[model samples]
Target: MSEAVTHSVPSASTSPGLLASLDPLLREWLPRQRWFAGKGRPVTGFSLVSATEVLPLNSGLGLLHLLVRAHQPLVPTQSAPAYPADCYQLLLGVRETLPPRLAPALIGHPTQGPLAGLTVYEALHDPRPADVLLEALRERAHLGELRFERDMAQEIRSDLVPRLVTAEQSNSSLVYGDTFILKLLRRIVPGINPDLELPLALARAGCARVPAPAGWILADLPADSLGPGQGDPGDPYVLGVLQPFLQGASDGWDLALREMAKGEDFSGAARALGRATAEVHTALARALPEVTMGRAQMEVLAEGMTERLTAAVQTVPSLLPYAPGLRSAFDALADLAGEGQTWTAQRIHGDLHLGQCLRSPSGSWSLIDFEGEPSKPLAERRLPQPTARDVAGMLRSFDYAAHSLRAEGTQVSAVSGWADACRAAYCSGYAEAGGRDPRTDPVLLRAYETDKAIYEVVYEARHRPDWLPVPMAAVRRLALPEPS
Candidate 1:
């Protein structure tokens, strides 16, 4: 069942004609994918950026590597201008008929197109195609405009078996032989991708709290395809990243829930996770340039937070009562900055939560997924931010775990106390690890935490109305004045 053999097929030319043929099928298929960002809008059409036939269709089983722009109608929002289209990296498998095993992966049989008579499905689900991808990465193959590169110092075995990770996620992943896991980003943008950039930086700094990338895949996109000022079109878009797999690791979220279920204290694990986070922060500071956010910068940051709150209150009217209280958090930060208060800023995991961590069988914690918030623009995600941003994210995650269990009908009256203890313990551990104590910077920490809660309120209100209460609870707590 392994299709690990390499083929010598000639690469296919990039053409709009090929995309014209697949347009109908793709329009029908794209919206249904979890990774497709334009979920509520209709796909107006598709424009091909690049296409390569990894394996020719004439070969009975074909694999096509495509980067297509999915055009969708704009939904106007008050805070930002709408983006008309999003680019996606697609690996399509073509066959005359699909086996029952791949039935779930089927996109559909194309009725009209170059693939008209064949059944087209997601290629990563087929091990043969997945194997081809890994082989390319191992060999550092250059097929058409796609570049498969690996660290010169690292050796990748070509025979590792590949299996698709079926988790409902924002991207696709393939685990190879329990040794390496490849994360393929579905939606793509120009410029340096932090998922690859951050890990490489951390590796150079000798930081063991994060996994180092072993290899990566990139695609050269056309200049016009990149939006205005994104970067030189010569900048390759990071499509996939391969890293060492933590074989026996347990997801931090799952581990926490288990401990809570048994009424056991999780403060110790939370504290260790905090220390690990501080270690990463310290390493990143040493490896990359850090900036000091002075009065001007802090004012701009506080202004952005205030604007976001204004927009969130408009969307979720339930936030109106707490709006004034929330406004105070941002205003206080701005007032302090007006008096010349300053803080350090550096690149951070823009969107951190318990779900982003893993605990090994031996109990060490490792952080993963540095891509930040998918909803944000690439430029914004890469900007330097205060370390408190990450600390606030982890603190909010503790509250989320407790509330999530309560939402599931767990009759635990001490849920709030459990969350509070973990939050305090985490900050204590962070200070012990030689990082500044977050508690001492109440103004900065409170501002970031309030900003995060506002984001969650808007997100939950739109996507999960029932779960809105989870963040709303935090809003209630955050809105109150800090105890002296």
Candidate 2:
């Protein structure tokens, strides 16, 4: 737990009419953001959940923190279910006129709000406001409902330079002098986020495969705002996380692609990554409680997978043909459970893929990002799941890397062989490190892989139609009988 101290608060300036005046501008700007989730749906309106004046606008440089709810029309399909309004976190910089250097961060000048006639841009893009956020974390400042806390054991410098990372999809990241990277979650959910919780737990367990959380920001919300039975009063939402940035580390996805393009073997790196993943899993098991999943739990899991497949087929008609074969994989796992087979369930990385890994210059591998599937509910993402789920996700990632660079309608035998070799090597490494081979449980592994493939199919169909064929190929393979 981090120590917190109250800081001098700014005068309240965010009134109910503030969001109403900014509504028109936000509706246009919010959808254009890369981190915005509701891309297809039109933003109907905005509701201000909470707003704080981080710095007074009387100064030339002002910072305002906002938590606003975006209302959109529900697009319910068999595959995609209806969801409630989404809350977003915004850090806005106020200036009388925009500077040429900060033109790209411009969110447009609001003509109707308290901030009318002032240019409001992304604060993270500016070094001054970004530094303010880091300083708050270093000081453990509690400004109103927003609290910035840091690991007492870790020392944070006051003079690191801040630069906003541009490639992020769901969240915004600011790298501070290659020493620390702060991930500010764009979507706001009122609960303990696994991204912060798991990393802190791994650090406590002395897991070197994951970066330790040096500091974090949280927002306290009313219990009633969280809805009934969601959480107790005073459960703070994880707003951002600060972690040590591994200098000279390469993304696993980029590394794999480079190796594949050169026709060089990536099995050794893949094997090392598998070992690192197993180490993280081992540490997570040690830090968190484990449970034995019984027949009832197995049935529930299988049923959920089946339902997802049903929905996917409804939305992506291409999946209709392979539905039966995919459903069989889930059925096999349920059958094994019916026969009294059980597996240990613990907190595993919910969304494990090559993109979530980093390879240091020294050739050591480290896993990053434990946020799980961003589309899932916070409670579900925090649930204990079978380790095979993560293994399946990585396995699919290997396959994706193999096909990612291939041309359309090209023969897949060579790339498929490469993916197969990497997969086998990874599983072998995991067995050597974790003492359990994922391949030993064929039924369970196949079920998880199939479920992951189904999820890929749905995601690709919705987001990247061109990439749909990649997961569709896996769906075709998983739907077939396993080699005897």
Candidate 3:
């Protein structure tokens, strides 16, 4: 979390209007927020897309729902390649005075706007607003274009207390009485959100490897005739999704770390997880469209990998030394394509890692977080890719676990043996579970793994400098002996 700093509250607007006090407050507060995508970039301007008072604004306590476009230009000039705008959802709670408990959630006090002298803060930080949001969904209430909906067959109790899930990074999740979990997407994008679409499809396919979807909240925006597929019903942007909360479940990342701490072998658990992953892949293949990409497509895929590597090298100069060898891995893929190699492309968990999975008390794995890479464009993430990409993600995760321990001042060589054992066991289990063994295609697997490592290099450099060695070590191994 960023250190708390005092900020000058925005001056209030002269007009007496709803949301009149928000512009200045958000300008100062949004950049400091963890969920804000444009953290390092300057927020040049803001445009209010929509604002509705879910709870009467005039009331002493207020709940205002806002959709604001944050305009962040790469260069503060008109000649730049169009301004990049990200629409964000803001749920604001207004009170006459800040309570002792809610002090941490304060955005700031507006001195001149409509909310002048009132304490304004993030509503999700308070249970009252969380409960209000859930109850509205239970009752299927509609406030303008924002629709709060739920599955009629699933009964939701209004009295169920809501508690925010704190471990999340990209999105916010709230658990209600341990029965249901609602995930609110802070960054809003137009079109179908795969997080919602994939789960619905998996449930319909009768896949038990995923938690059942209970309900969802969405925003139906006015049609943009200029947009592609303007008449499509999926024009509505998904705001949040509700699903059953796993009561006795532990995240796979934590489970692996715990096993490592005990010096116990995780091969058995890794094998089971591999099988579960295959099951979900098979179910997704049955539920969605599948296509075969020939040599030409494989070349395109290889080129994309090379492009990402080149981009990462520019950002993380440490990658410069290994760029050639990394490019050779991609070149290997292209060479295979030249030999007429073909692969299957289908809907996959674009971003799959240990943390994205959960292990139930029964020892079964449940996949979650189907939103894909939050930084990637939605259309690109939606495109079908090799299932091996998901396998590579998990494979890299094992390596990450090993390196994480080393970073924690517990340097040991034993983690390598454990990770290798888990990787082999996982591949064997995947083969047994009716999926092709990733090890069988070493070139493809290596290429994908290399790509994933390069991505991690850039990510670690930007986020955790201390963690850069984790991926840098992988980069060194990927590079060859270099004419020894």
Candidate 4:
């Protein structure tokens, strides 16, 4: 079984009535869904930018393309790295969206509000979506339940069968075994995917921080094969990949709570996770030896920031106060770039978040998923990124864990303290494992944190307007003072 999503409405040329259009599916329901970025606020309105229907499509398996314009600030971090929120399309479905459309945010119920009236649900737990999707992709799409279950925990040496947690993706579904998760792919790629590619290499080298390859399923995609004009109209993307399911696995955020909860701090785990991260990075680098990243990469980051800064300032005029200060910071970071390459770069996990990591039953940490995300194109996601890119992402994950606990309704002061401890623990671990002291150079940490936070702020504003303040909170977390 593949991780599939289902919903009451799907967008296609022959879609259902008002409740079936992409707009109605997520109209007043944006503020209620967990996956929905903005909850609590009634939607002003939403518009469909574009929607493509899945070919050879079936009824129960209604596949379509959809881009929505909702009333909220766009988030840069939670989204694709490029083209910050002018307009974007997210493959979505129904089952992922709660029936009531009114559910609590991770931490805030009344305050955080519901998924109703938000945007859309990307995936679902119901099997309907997954069943239909898999059938279609396998060219045998149908409406039926999978009667495959085993009593014991599985190592999942084969393909994954994650549940249809929701239906909202470009080519992915949420599948779960008794002890592993398998994200099934809908689209197929001719070459290999970096997500599964790097982790397997690391695992083969006996790396531990990452989840070892359980098994993988290969499919054909004559449609998306390389070169222009040589693709199939009816081809489903890569089918999917499978991995060991973690039982009650705590994420970086959850681990943060345990650390703070015991007052022992997560320093131990951070160090361990850091060492594991380092090893994984080292192994990955071996597979990608041509990392000649230099100022050229910095130029890309700077240019992207420049464009986003412009867009953000326009959408969230309140950002005006920090605009000049932000620009100055960008310049300072850019100044550090050297004409000659100073650091190695490689194709890495483009979309890394707290959700990407898990705490094992043995109290060890394991990472998952190399595919950055569905929103990003595979080519861009596989681009060589600075080691700092991964480092910054890890740092952000630490912060996200701590802060997300607060969002889960932890007392602000308490979660804040835990967050601090977790942050320290993670950094300490990274330093001990990475064998580098970035925190010592407060300026360096500040620059990196700002860049990360800028991304978070934009991403939250667009995805979770209510949570936008969370990233904004990092504004003060930076070592830099408000510019005069």
Pitting candidate 1 against candidate 3, the one with the higher lDDT is 1
Instruction: TM-score for candidate 1, please give it.
Output: 0.96
Off by over 4 Å in 4: 1-180, 186-191, 223-237, 258-264, 338-341, 403-409, 412-417, 440-447, 477-484
lDDT by residue (tens digit), candidate 2, 434-475 = 999899999999999999999888888878998888898899
Task: Put down candidate 4 lDDT per residue, 162-182, tens digits, no spaces.
Answer: 465454344444555454455
Q: Pick the candidate with the highest lDDT.
A: 2
**What lDDT, from 0 to 1, does candidate 1 have?**
0.87
Model 1, 1-484: lDDT tens digits are: 1222234545443543567778877888888898988887888888777788888876899999888888777777642322446889999999999999999999887675577788989999999999988889877887777888888677789889999998847899999999999999998887789999999999999999999999899877675564555557577789999999999999999999989988889999999998998999999999888999999999999999999999899899999999999999999999999998899999988888999999999989999999998878888888999999999999999999998898778876566699999999999888989557888999999999999999999988888988988999999999998787
Which clashing pairs does model 1 show? Answer: none
Query: How many clashing pairs does model 4 include?
Result: 75
RMSD for all candidates, in order, please: 2.9, 2.0, 6.4, 9.6
Candidates in order, TM-scores: namely 0.96, 0.96, 0.91, 0.63
Candidate 2, clashing residue pairs? none
Stretches off by above 4 angstroms in model 2 are: 1-5, 77-83, 226-230, 408-416
CA lDDT, every prediction?
A: 0.87, 0.88, 0.82, 0.53
**Per-residue lDDT value at 333 in model 2:** 94
lDDT of model 2, residue 412: 43
Please report, as a residue range, the 10-residue window in candidate 3 with the lowest summed lDDT. Answer: 1-10
Candidate 1, residue 268: how far the Cα is off, in Å:
0.2
On lDDT, the stronger of 2 and 4 is 2
User: Model 2, residue 361: what's the lDDT?
Assistant: 97
